[model samples]
Target: MTACKNEQLFNPDIRLATLDDLTALVALEELAFNYDRLSRRSFRRAIMSDGSVLLIAVGAQGLLGYALLHLRQGTRLARLYSLAVASFARGFGIGIRLLKACEQKAINTGKTLLRLEVSALNQVAITLYQKMDYREFGYYHAYYEDQSDAIRMQKPLRHMSVEQSSHPLPWLAQRTPFTCGPVSLQMVLSAFNPNYQATPEDELDIWREATTIFMTAGHGGCHPMGLALAAQKRGLSAKVWLSQEGPLFVDSVRDQLKKAVIERVHYSFMKQCKTEDIPVHYSVMPLAQLITAFDSGALAIILISTFRMDGKKSPHWVVMSGYDEHCILVHDPDFEEKDPNQSPLDCQYMPIARDEFEKMSRFGQRRLQATVVLRAN
Candidate 1:
């Protein structure tokens, strides 16, 4: 299904995939592949996820093909997760149209490279990729569910040479989805003290100590003051800065009892901080002030909404590894890339634009901003 004849360049209208296109895209997924298919659930998430780009091609006959791209946040590379055309529509130029659109979108979004892996058995697709200027870079053994190999190919989205940037911190991926708070803590601690080894057990322990069980979606996530207290108990001096007082993530919970429990936890955390003399500032830390604090030799564990990354309206934590005038460098513990060749460094000290960071730093209708600042005693 990869090869297309140059039969008079069939053009199709392309647009971003939406919820309305879900059923069509799902049917198209079924029509396209036998193994390693994207499910209906995956399509829904990608449609809503901020980290993904899903595009659909529409011709006079309807959805001819679609392409899904994974936008690597903080990196210049974008991965073509999937591309499919209707079985009857394969020989037309639909795949070419979808792929070129992907390249243009990648370039528009600051990605300099578009990478994909095609089954080595499918020389047609590999030929299409090559015709589009994609070069073979690597290969994966048994990369497919059917134990078939894949040939990795990539094409520069832009024609210019751009240098890559790396973060200044040792990187570690969060073992569980809910452990980003602790994983960020673990990374910052590794920077603070080299001999301090991080473990999965410790990650769960810190999560248990800090989680508020606020959201009913899957699991309760860590609280700001709770995270600060957990780290403080571990001997690092800690302070909690918040946008508003009382409780955090109260808006995320629906049941009355759960909200009350969150409030109770917040009160207890405040009282405990008072008793322990740990500083809890009842104000949002301005960017300038945060820069000053960072310059004073402190690492920050900050809360941001996943809406900007995964299109999910929930809280996620990342370490503020460093910052410059234009971009804020961070170590996001939640690494979602599944490609084996992609390294953990992909998410380490990733550069997010300053203005975009400011927008992503807040969550929910109240725009809650919170951070746990850690320092040497």
Candidate 2:
């Protein structure tokens, strides 16, 4: 393989991988991981794919280590798909250099955050990631081919300047499985009125006030209009954005009675919105518009498909707080589990790409898009 011109200042041999290095990459993968190793074909594709960046460290002898970063389509998040160093090269600081190179590549591509999953048992890598400011946000059970658990970690790359700020919104974990909407609303409301106490009681109150009776499963999700009305009830000015102007979530229910209940609840919300003279837009609100609203001090509660974050195809709500050219930051009120080590802040100020935000800002087979913008009157 030809020497890369942009060599590392310290090593003078680290650079982007080319297709010519596929054989070495395969060898390195085999050496580094006995299980969950990338196949030769996968390494070849990664080397050639525009959606990925593979950085390799070389020596006079040949390949020493490599880091592979995968850019998620339509998202500002980049995943460090793999990182490995030859067993002989372990103590030479090659891993850190490869990681830094991957982070730089991600930032150059306008990515704001770098995330990865490492086996929980990999203490050395975990310590290195922590030292580099990567924080564990969550974990995946049996993530590996060998049924090993992996810890999800993330580090912010851009939007770190003091000028880049998130709204002073407090994150509240949903007390119940179906209270994400209410909890998100509570967080935004608390941002407006610091005296507003966001409690589990209030969460259920809001849910009762707003739920559509049935989602894709038990205990219906909140309708955007219902959420808007709930915010209004709490003395906040609200606007509702809907992609379609009909009963929401009705299509997800198979039982006629359940469908009718959902439709009735949705129409009831529409009537309340009308009676209160709330502005309901029957079109998709552009991300730019939502950003503008956020910039103007409006708190946004948005409905999104959880499929991107987790593999679940369910609708969920998150409170949008800030935005930049690279990402839209929000406080997600739902945590999959309660861990003493994981703080609510871990879920707050989470950066999501504008494009991915748009794709995720909808749910279900009908692809329903909805948002509730609120501000203190």
Candidate 3:
């Protein structure tokens, strides 16, 4: 599938569907699906429902994709009602983007379970959903009137309850500047509040005892858990940085990575770099600190991405490692976001040697960029 022009999917534009969007939405839907699909009138009613949500994706070129969410208020269950992408923009990851937007909406509304039904015949979509960790619950025989079987899938968001659960948000205690290689890095961790510290005996070890932690880097979700568990097996402390994404999204990811060897660390920031108070043991410096720390210590790096980054453009994650006469060393988690030809595997962490660093720096310096950090909170 060919994605639309760059300007069509690169813009940070998303909002709830309004009556004003009916004309454009109806047209797109009619063109993308068969007539048996819900009529415009039905679409209008769903949009107006209190427990339902409709999200529209738009770029400079206009409508790209739309997602409909059916949420059962008061209960923690949600469903992907429908999703459609503009015919011209099939390959640009619009479906996943719409799905993510719907997931975020469901989480924001306090839903803990997100489910969906996909046509069994659609192998492409089935593969994408499976790769995203949507488990098949069952199948409805010939559920579609057109003689198509339906695959029922579900994703649970247990960790999303962290905010509502008795558990509190993790906080930073103190940062001690340490050297990894030729660079200076600091370790960050959660600290007890002054009033809450009933006993001065509570030490870094107490806060470092993160029963659960989330990581949101490009590759963090896919691999760090293994390293973290290995380190924990050796009796080492580990923490992860989580992005403020949907609970279902985050929890689904955790389910895939959780192992007996490691425990989770609470860094307490969705946008890790933006948070000024970096957690103890958690370093904000990316590649520079990682290369240094990994060389001397076991600092595990997690790379994450919804898609591959385009080398022709600036990346989402950029870190300064060490500059030498020949080249620079860096680790880029957002490389997938920059690559236009991104796939599920591209979300993993990528290491750039000294030679490649100079090439990217020169490319990034010439590009204008901005980041819209979505906080799950």
Cα-based TM-score, every candidate: 0.62, 0.64, 0.41
- Which candidate achieves the best lDDT against the true structure? 2
Where does model 3 exceed 4 Å of error? Answer: 1-4, 158-377
Query: Distance from true position, residue 237, model 3, in Å?
Result: 53
**Clash totals in order:** 2, 0, 30
lDDT values for all models: 0.80, 0.82, 0.45
Q: Comparing candidate 2 with candidate 3, which one achieves the higher TM-score? A: 2
State the TM-score for model 2: 0.64
Candidate 1 segments whose C-alpha is farther than 4 A from its true place = 1-70, 73-107, 111-167, 337-343
RMSD of 2: 8.6
Colliding pairs, model 2 = none
**Candidate 2 lDDT, 1-377, residue by residue in tens:** 33332233237378888888989989888879989888877777777787788889997658889988887544566788889988866777888999999999999987778888899989999999999989986777888888989998888886643234567777789988899999999988888898999977899999999888786677888888989999999999999989997888877878899988888887888889999999999999888788788888898899998897767888899988777666688788877574322334347667777778888988887888898999899
* Candidate 3 backbone overlaps, count: 30
Error of 1 at 58 (Å): 25
Let me know the TM-score candidate 1 reaches against the reference structure.
0.62
